[model samples]
Target: MPLNIVLLDDEQHVIDLLSAYCESIDAADIVGRFSNPIQALNFINNHPVDLLISDINMPQVSGIELAQSLTRDVKVIFITAHSDYAVAAFELDVIDYIVKPVLLPRFLKAISKAQNAISASEPSTKELGNRELSNREQSARYIFVKDGGVKKRLVFDEILFLHAQGDYTEIRLKDKKLLLLGTLSSFQQLLPEGEFVRIHRSYIVNKSNVDSVDKDHLNIDGQDITIGKTYRQNIDEIF
Candidate 1:
């Protein structure tokens, strides 16, 4: 039987591109395309899918959550614009993650990955995988944080680190910064376990950005930061 699949993305252009490709592919049956995550989730619950092609960043809920709910029976290939989500995406055991704006060849490669995952035997650590998948699902790869009345969606990969000050979280981006309403713990939970570590109670740094680490000090992109006593052991393993 041809693999039954669903494609979910907030961008109509992306959905149009992927839908066309899936229709052209011989092995897949393009079941539907949904811009809304809730609608996609409902459809998946009512249907049996062999594979799902989804966007990691979406409004309200993410593709990660949808993938977690159907991981046992369906393979997921996430499409995202950021690289930081890559670590968490892998942890979820997604067949692949295709960064946007997605090229046709790359999108096809994701489909290939899903096919392989479907053919592969069930993994031994289903429960552990499920739990890990849930954490990654709920974690935000792209945050729609509000600065006053203005709302902005920031990709997590663009953020250098978050600085906590009382009730607000300082979002330091690659180019600029934004002071948003959130806690340090909330940002930490959104980051992948091995890829991001809490260097201090108020700071979460991406391991991929760390230039060097010795004892209590960590150098990330020429910036010096200290490792908290509580997070020392965990940081050590990553370095």
Candidate 2:
């Protein structure tokens, strides 16, 4: 039987691209494509799907949260522009994590892994080979951010904090800073929740890099940043 698959991403273009890719695969069937994670989750709950291709960052619900909420045994493949969510994806035992600006060849490789996983889970009529099909890798400890058309790899340990700068975000490192064209909320969803903390509406600090903390502000690398009043509760818990 062909694998029943569903696609979910906030971008309609992404949904279209992934849908076309699923159609190209001989053993896959495109069951649905949704821009809303909640709608996709509801569909998955009411239907039988073998795989879910999802984007990590969404408005109402994140793909990671959606995968965590599922009670069924559906394999997931995360497609996103950010690699910060790699740790969380691996924790969820997703079939693959494909970075965005997704090339067709790379996407095909991910689909192949999903196919192997689905096949392995079924009762085989003949003896299967001993070839290992697992795709889990060492959790990613860094991410590549595109700056001025160049991809700059930044290790997680080197990052001090992320500050929202209008339409872009400033990534503060140990020595310098880089601007990325995305929102703070997007990065918040990308980074591992345990390592990064949202101290304010405009700032997300690397908890390990924090030097000190007070009621109104926290010091990271000796630079004090204001803590939002609404986020004071989280700061209280951390301190």
Candidate 3:
């Protein structure tokens, strides 16, 4: 299911940019975009939202205050130019605190963090105590992939990297590899942003599996992957 998202920013351009970014991610659905904090608050109260992307400094009501007024279950990601609010943003337990001007890659990373947080909060079948289910049960940690005639479930944490094939994507795990009929861009939208990064045009590496990184390349579990020039700036910010 795509996550319902709400974007709030006083600046029209910021709102437009964020809305466009959200639209690019297949997992996110921007249900509301508002320049006024009060209108955003009202919309959120009336609609169901899985994530909230908001600017820190606004007119009448601040983003921090707006977040405080929300229910505990709502996840928030703060985007702002000032660094002084970092401590306060974290105090509210926001999913991420991004300093502007926000780059596409960095924004993607923050969105991924929010997705993971929301996934973690969802109740699993096991948690609900349903014992009649089959042994092959699906959970937030795994995704179902069809390989040839068989359907396989791949765990998110077990994945090491994903490389783009002609029109398909090859997912590399610690023990095996799976090929799916999809593009790198599609995978980019589906996968959590915080855990995976597009080091190259054809490759997305799991940040947790990354062992080390240098100027031009990054090592992931003994395998070396070249970092693309265009992504260097974002990669630098990450490491």
Model 1 C-alpha lDDT per residue in residues 86-172, reported as the tens digit of each score: 888888888888877788888778777777766675653543554564465447666455577777887767767778875468877
Tens-place lDDT per residue, model 2, 1-239, is: 67778888999899888878877988877666788898789757545567899999999999999999886678999999999999999999999999999899999999889888887786432112101111111156765656876888877788899998854789999999999865565455456548889988789999999999988999998899999999999989977
- Tens digit per residue, CA lDDT, model 3, 111-138: 8898888787766433233222211232
Q: In model 3, what are the clashing residue pairs, if there are any? A: 112-193
Candidate closer to the true structure by TM-score (higher is better), 1 or 3: 3
- TM-score attained by model 1: 0.49
Instruction: Mark the regions of model 1 whose C-alpha exceeds 4 Å error after superposition.
Output: 122-239
* CA deviation > 4 Å runs, candidate 2: 122-239
Report the lDDT of model 3 for residue 51. 82
lDDT of each: 0.73, 0.80, 0.80
TM-score of 3: 0.52
Number of colliding residue pairs in each model: 0, 0, 1
Model 1 clashing residue pairs (backbone): none
**If scored against the real structure, what TM-score would every candidate get?**
0.49, 0.51, 0.52
Error of 1 at 189 (Å): 39
